[model samples]
Target: MHIVAVGLNYRKAPVDIREKFTFSDESLPVALQQLKRTKSILECVILSTCNRTEIYAVVDQQQVCGHYIRSFLANWFQIEIGEFADYLTIYEDNEAIRHLFSVTAGLDSMVIGETQILGQVRNAFLLAQKHNATGTLFNMLFKQAITMAKKAHSETSIGENPVSVSYAAVELGKKIYGNFKNKNVMIIGAGKMSELTLKHLHANGVGKIVVANRTLQKAKELAGQFAGTFCSMGQLEEMLVEQDIDIVISSTGADGYVLTLEQMEPVMKKRKSKPLFMIDIAVPRDLDPRLMDMPNVYLYDIDDLEGIVESNLEQRKREAMKVDKLIEHELEMFHQWYRLLGVGPVIGALQEKANRIHQETMSNMLQKLPDLTEREIKVIRKLSKSMLTQMLHDPIMRIKELSAGRRGVEELDLIRELFALEDMLKEQARLPKDFLLESKPSESDDDRISPVNPVLA
Candidate 1:
């Protein structure tokens, strides 16, 4: 069978397009079952997140797998093929494996090195497994992917740095105070940026939060979300001086600077020159630039935070190189297992045929020489089976080695031809019942590793 992945991510499609293809958690089991019933899909998993939606499948035909998956999406989501065809990207076999590994490791995420994608992949695999939509191949492949991601995170610093603007603000705070614990924060706006910054601060266990906005109701609404207190723009000066605010994040839509150096000078003096941190995230510059030059005043603008984000992004890129090497190693291991799967049925059929011939020969010799003692017949049967097993052992080992190497699918056919097992394979019922050619190959099946040689033991 062939492995295939077909999907559109944030890089390939906009939010609107990606959202249209998402699968709700409640619908995933039914969706997976339906996808598995498609002509080429034997096993399937759907990974649907806000940024991307993808389907990974094991299929009977590589050529038709993509078309069938697209059709499945079109029918299930009620979207036209033409509507999303341009956004779709399909990877087959090794490429499919590589893509999954990269995605699970967060290399393919819109935000590189983000850990959320790894959990999403794990959830997708688990959901598929719970629904019986995944078999041996996917079970192994996805487990490896999840394990690799965990390894990447633990072994590298890929996720250690902050890459978003709001996060950068927090990281800068860390540089000055190590952490925000027991520090009061005053957020100067009711905008989305202000809310996000407040969230990061609240999560860091800041002592107290005060939201200040020109509109008192808007400030109250934003503060209520985080269990923070609110103050009108007119009370900004009084709140700073009275509350001993340690951090000030300003992102107002006003045209002029909200806090000037002159305004903060008296406040800093009144607070006994205590350090004050401020972040100006507004487009028109809410916090005064000259305030940064004042003693005990730590101030940063959008440009400064963006620079930190860019630097952090570069650091993540460097770490991703290490993850790539890990991915390469996992891909090799997966291919090794896959190669053995291809040769398993052929080897099983060969052993089954050899046993049939050995049984017939032994029975005929025993019947022809009935005068021989029972002990003699038993000895002869044991010796005959041993000889056959000894002869098959070396060849079986060599075949396994070749299959696990760079040998292609055509080599399996050649091996079958040499053993004259072609006819036996065609007679499906006569083939060994243990050798399930269409289903997943068992790793514990002796024939997969040693063929008829195990009979000697």
Candidate 2:
């Protein structure tokens, strides 16, 4: 099967168009199942975030697969085909496969070397699995992709910076507070972004954390896991007063400001102007934009983060040169395995022709010399099969070696030409008069490696 990717991402589509395609946490399983149900698909994953929406699927027919996926996506988002189609992009075969590996390695991310994408990809794969929307092809593809990501992180400096928007909030916290060891941080939402930000904080040994959300159950559930305090929205103002919260990272999905300048005035007063660092890491921001004008208050909206994140991006680009070789080497290894898969049918045809010749001669001899040499005839047949196997051994081994290096796909077509394999099966009709073709070739059941993922383990 061929690898195919179709979707619009941050580079090509504006926020409005992207938001329309964003899949909430609840929609992934259904989306995965829907994609897998399309024609020629063997596996599927849907990655939808505020910045981008992409689908990775393994399919057989590119013509049908591309249109089916595009149509499915357009229908799901309730967009007219002609209107939205222009915003979508599709990459097929090698281009699609390479893009996936590159993306997992942070090569194609908006933030040049973001590490969060690996986790995002893993989540998509898990969701696909949950819905039984995957098979062997995807199991191998994703495993390799994850492995590639790990290698990129360990061997390269790409993941050295937190390129994701969630972690950008942590960077902002660090800049404002200098040290989080003495800070009481309050996270306003219990979403994935909030959880990731908490992880970064926990690693840095933040003083304490508190979860204040609209739902007490969610607040308690999330807070308990992070060893933090929790309170419902009714107790938000009181919680803010009690914690002496040094930094506020708010990102709830509220329609308007969750907190206004006037609302935080009294809370700030109680702290004696402790320089509250507030980060509105949300769209339709969780706080009033005017809150920044308050004395001793450092409020950084998302725009302020771009500068810090950009510096981090610059550092990643400098270190990327070091990791470049590692990625190239890994891609070469994967390429080799893919090329080796093309030899299967050619080898099968060779063995089929040899076995048929042996069978026909055996039947003729057995009939012609019925009693003269029954034992001798059996010995000759065994010798003939053994000789044929030995003759074919060199070509098979060479085919494998040629398929094992960089850009091995280039060698597959050449191998097919050199061996005259396109016509090998046609020669089957030239069998001797007494020859009887076997019901099934002896090697027909041998293991085959498909080029998409020749091997994973």
Candidate 3:
């Protein structure tokens, strides 16, 4: 069996292409079940967020796993493979494992060392397990990934300096309006990113915060967290016209532009050319692009924050070197676990054959000497058992050592041939179920960390 990951991220695909492949919260379980049922796919998990969508799976066929995953995406998302095939990236075996570890460790995020991706990874793994989409392989792999991420964050200061798209947006606003104490901020979303932006603004001492959402209650709740006021989506245009809203931060799930050029033209006109600085962090972009062309209107989308993100990354990059070391350690542990799956049954079968031969030989001898005392017979049995154990101990130890190296499977095959254990080995087939039953609980379980709410990017 092989571990494989196929997907696109912010580095490989733009937000427009990335948004097309996203699996909504309501659609994730169904998509997972469907993918699990696909040919060659044994176990699966889907991780979808604003920036990326990744599918991790254990498959019987290494060469064709990517094709199957792409096919699954096409069927699930109802788009042709050509539409996204070029954007998709595939990794197998060790590369797949390393990618997952790096992603969880925050080394692969657009904002390096961001803590939110850790929680996102944990949520995806848990949801997959809950819906029975994961088996032995994924349960171990994902738990290890989560444990590694926690270690990376705790041991290093990668996430120490709070830098995110939201934080960057606030900084950009400060450039236009130096003193936020008198600047009125309007955040047009109730999601986590919007709340985070509001938090940054609150820290900067912004005045008159208003959160607008499709649902007034959610808007009210988010606004209440920052001691700000709320308004409904219907009231958004009215508030833009009536209030002296200096800066606007918009992040929403709308399919199209929430603030269109036609809608904003009149609002901008009413302001009589008062400069309105806007930041749109949504994937489908809540604010219209044409709004940027208007006089005295400055609009920045998610991609615009990259420059700000880059400038503040030197210190985090230094810390990320520490995270890379942690990933290497975790990767070795995963490899060792994988090796055990290959050799465990071989060792069991070898020992079983040795014990069988010892028992049969003793049974025939005892029958030939029927007059022997019960005590003598017991002594003979005990001595012969000890001799059999002693004879096999060295070979067993050697087998374990060989299994940890590069040519493990080849060396194991030779051992199986010598013992005439081909039939027994064939019956095992290296399926995840057999190993799960034979294996001990992973060390990660004892050290598993709770999911954390991200304070930074």
* Tens digit per residue, CA lDDT, model 2, 109-171: 766777777888888888787788877667766778888788778877777757777778888
Candidate 1, position 299, lDDT: 81
Candidate 2 lDDT score relative to the true structure: 0.74
- Those runs of model 3 whose alpha carbons end farther than 4 Å from true positions after fitting are 427-457
Q: Please give the range of 10 consecutive residues that has the lowest summed lDDT in model 1.
A: 447-456
TM-score of each: 0.68, 0.72, 0.89
Clash list (residue pairs), candidate 2:
360-435
**Candidate that would win on lDDT:** 3
- The candidate with the higher lDDT, 2 or 3, is 3
Over 4 Å off, model 2: 63-66, 81-89, 110-114, 130-132, 161-164, 173-186, 195-210, 214-218, 221-229, 234-248, 251-304, 401-457
Mind giving the per-residue lDDT tens digits that candidate 3 earns over 1-457?
A: 8999999888888877887787778888889899999999999999987778999999999988899899999988899999999999898999999999999888888778888899999999999999999998999999999999998889899987888768878878887778699889999989888988999999999989999999999999999998888999888778987778988999888777888899988888888989998998887678888888999999998777775756568889999998888898889888777776666677767765765677678779978999999899878877877777777777777877887777777888788888889877676565566574787866332222211111110
- Model 1 misplacement above 4 A: 164-199, 203-308, 423-457
Question: What's the CA RMSD for each of the models?
Answer: 10.7, 7.0, 7.5
